[model samples]
Each structure stands twice: as structure tokens, then as C-alpha cells.
Target: MTAISLPSAMEFIWLEADLLDSHDYAAWLALWTATGHYIIPTERDAEDYAAVLNVVYDDQEMREARVKRLQSGLSMSASPAARTVRTVSRFRAMDGAAGVFVVRCAQHIVEYKYDRTRMLAADVLFWLVPAASGISLQRKVVTLINGDDALHGIGYLL
Candidate 1:
């Protein structure tokens, strides 16, 4: 696997945010590896998600199921289909082993739906691996800035 350059990593990050904002679920799903995990914790200090409850803990299969639900329009929470815009910044690439890297960044995401708009600030950590096409996500950990705070329906992807 070729080492992922800084520019390439940044491009990958941008592409992901764009795809999500565009509601291109199929395209975004293709960016993950077979064993990729997407997690959102309720506790910022929690280490074991299995032992402690998490807001979102999605494996590939779970992710696919979620996409299906959103696309099928059966989810009542997604009735109007929320619109989202995300800005990714403060990206720093950290070495992971020989070829892999861990990217840390801050994401400011705004979601609009149901005649309401909500803003969420989050810190994201992505485990990136080189793939045949480009980079694939091994894991994505999103820590909400207000993790411990009471949140309304967060039905949309953040």
C-alpha cells in the first residue's frame, strides 16, 4: 500500500463531507472497508462502548441497514429528510504503524429539518487505510462536544 500523502488525505476528508452533505449515502458507504466501524459516544470519557451505551455504534451491516431505512423513507424521523452542511478543519495526520494514519479533525455540522435547525460541534477521529481506489475508513469515532448534554432527536447522520 502506498503511503497516503497529506494532500490526498485532505482531499479524502473533503470528499466524505461533501458526499454526506449531498445525501449521497451509497457513495459515502463505499468509502469504508469491510470491517469499518462508525461510533458516536454518549460519554466523552468512555472507553468500552460495548460495556457502556453509545449513541451510535455501527458496523458495515448496521450502516447498510441505516442507509436502507433512510432511502426507503419508512423512518418517521426522516420523514422530511434533514439537510446537512459540514465543515471539517484542524486536520492533523498522525502516524499509525507503517502505512496507516489516524486523522484528527473538528467538524461543525448544521442540520435543518422539521422547521428547525440544529448545530453540532464534534471532534472526529478517522482511522484511514490505503485501498485499491484510494483511502478506506477502518474506523470513525465522533465525539460530540455536548456528549453529556440532553439532545433532541438526532435522527440524521452527523
Candidate 2:
């Protein structure tokens, strides 16, 4: 198992958020492994992934397609490019078996564009491994604080 420090793990998470906020899709995509998944479930306490409806469940292919759309300048939602500021806190890391690390953090993001500001909050979990380029995400799960409520035009990464 590759030994990775907790501080290093936190740094990696911070950098990921920064990249997303900066709309650096290429860099953000590079932080994930080929088989990584991004999940946002509709149920706040949902455990069975296959049973409940999901707000977003993006695999590698889906992620790539989304990035492609974002880069192509064809996504109307991103035409004005909502500028975002993300605050990640309460970051903690745990060692998983087989050299994997589980990172948990709370995130609050404020987005402004289209003449309106929106705030989103969530608890995020990341399964990561120490890879050649520092850390690679194996899975990312985000449970919105108000997952059961209505959300509008969530076309960008959170």
C-alpha cells in the first residue's frame, strides 16, 4: 500500500475544488481515475445505488461527454459561465483497505451569474488512491443538504 499523508490528501481535495471553481475542466478530469464515478442521489439517506433515483450518476464516459460539451462552447447553461466560489471544510481522511483513502468534507458553494446568486451546500465523500499524479478519485458522492428539495439548472460541477 502506498503511504499517503492525511495532509496530502486534504491538499488534493482542496486543489480539486479549486480546479472545479476555476472551470478548469481538463485539470479536474485528470484528477479522476478511468473508472471513477460521480454520484448525487435524490434520497438523503439512500444506500442502495441501484434502487433509488439519482440526481446525477456520472461514469467516465458521461464525465468525458460533459466536459466535451462544456469545452465546445455549446452548453447554453455555461454560455455565461456561472462563476463559483467553493468553501470546503471539516476535511478528514481515513485509510481504506488496498491503499485507498476515504476523504470526507463539507462544502458550501456560492454561484453568481444570469443576474442571480445561488448557494449550494453538501457533504461530500471521495474514494481516492495514490496515483502517479498524486491522487486519483475512484468515486465521489455528494449528498446535498436539501437533496429532497427542488434545485434549478444544476448544469455545472458542484
Q: Residues 1-158, candidate 2, lDDT per residue (tens digit)?
A: 35567788788889989999888999898899998888898898887765789988899899999888877788888776788999998988866667788988999999998788999999999898888777788999999998889988875788
lDDT of 1 by residue, 47-158 (tens): 7776788888999999999888887878888766788889999999876766677899999999888788889999998889999998998988899999878987866677
Runs in model 2 deviating more than 4 A are: none
- Model 2's alpha-carbon lDDT is 0.86
User: Model 2 residue 43 lDDT?
Assistant: 91
- Which ten-residue region of model 1 has the weakest summed lDDT? 93-102
Clashing pairs in 1: none
Q: What are the runs in model 1 whose C-alpha is more than 4 Å off?
A: none
TM-score for each candidate, following the candidate numbering: 0.93, 0.92
Q: By summed lDDT, which 10 consecutive residues of candidate 2 come out lowest?
A: 1-10
| Number of the top-ranking candidate, with lDDT as the measure | 1
C-alpha local distance difference test of each model:
0.87, 0.86
